[model samples]
Target: MGENELAEQFGVTRAGIRAALIDLEAQGLVERIRNRGSRVRVVTVEEAVAITECRMVLEGLCAAKAAVAASDEQLAELTALGRAMTKAVADGEPVTYSDLNRELHARIREFSGRRTAVELLERLNAQLVRHRFQLALRPGRPQRSLKEHLAVIETIEARDPQAAETAVRAHLGSVIEALRG
Candidate 1:
């Protein structure tokens, strides 16, 4: 949609839409085409894999740092979130599971105490949200993901940074493979 239309639909100013579009364009999720205006960029499988690979490393770092830096309260929160995700999966609510999944990761990043890495990972995550959500819809994927998430949380709770990193990388690598399939 045009900036004016988007602004009207979102109840924001034209400048707001323009700014948001600029950010999206920078993230390679959208592009401005002169007369054609801005459009959602089609992500190829290769591009998706690249994004997933980047996420694997960044998130692994986040998990590792979180293992070392997270307070007992933060660890409890993660455990609760993981339980909630398990419930969501058992209820067969993919949408809820996906939302909880994102929240769990964000919580880990927040607890990591690394502002720069968290910021970069958040931006990369925004770009990957669409693909990630689609992947979450695949049969049995949500259950598998919940199991992986719980395993990561277990490692974090154990205060094993290396194990936490390995768990996160393995989870993200599985996500990349699923996306490829």
Candidate 2:
């Protein structure tokens, strides 16, 4: 909130701090008022649901495309990641599973070969970190989502684009429901 304080702590100029704030504001990570300075932006529950709704569509497209476009090597990596996620859940490490969940989604996006969708997903995901993390730590949440995610990987490995897209929508639809709670 204090640009001068930030500048002094980082030994940077006020202009530099202001510029950084500008970028964060553009990213929806901060809110700047005309004269009240800047503060961390809080994403409301409704906004989270809206964001997840958007993700359900875009990520479904990515999953479907990845099913068709992913190379053999990419398939192998995704399979391995699924196994790792299973192990993480079985070992009672939701945090680790959550991290692997991110990796799995990222790989799918990359394999889809849709640069624009991947970029937009990245921006949207940046806004969901807190909600996603909290959900990951919720009791039984990881276990439930694990099967959904595995279904996505399984369908993609089966080279079924329609099924892959359905699986992705199902997964994110559950996310939307949870966010609404």
lDDT of each: 0.92, 0.95
Model 2 spans with C-alpha error above 4 angstroms? none
After best superposition, candidate 2 residue 9: deviation in angstroms? 2.9
Q: Model 2 lDDT vs. the true structure? A: 0.95
> CA shift at 159, candidate 1, in angstroms?
0.4
- The 10-residue segment with the lowest total lDDT in model 2: 172-181
- On the 0 to 100 scale, the lDDT of residue 92 in model 1 is 94
RMSD of each: 1.7, 1.2
Write down the TM-score for model 2: 0.95
Off by over 4 Å in 1: 7-16
lDDT value, residue 107 of candidate 1: 97
Error of 2 at 52 (Å): 0.5
TM-score for predicted model 1 compared with the true structure: 0.92
Top candidate (lDDT): 2
The residue pairs found clashing in candidate 1 are none
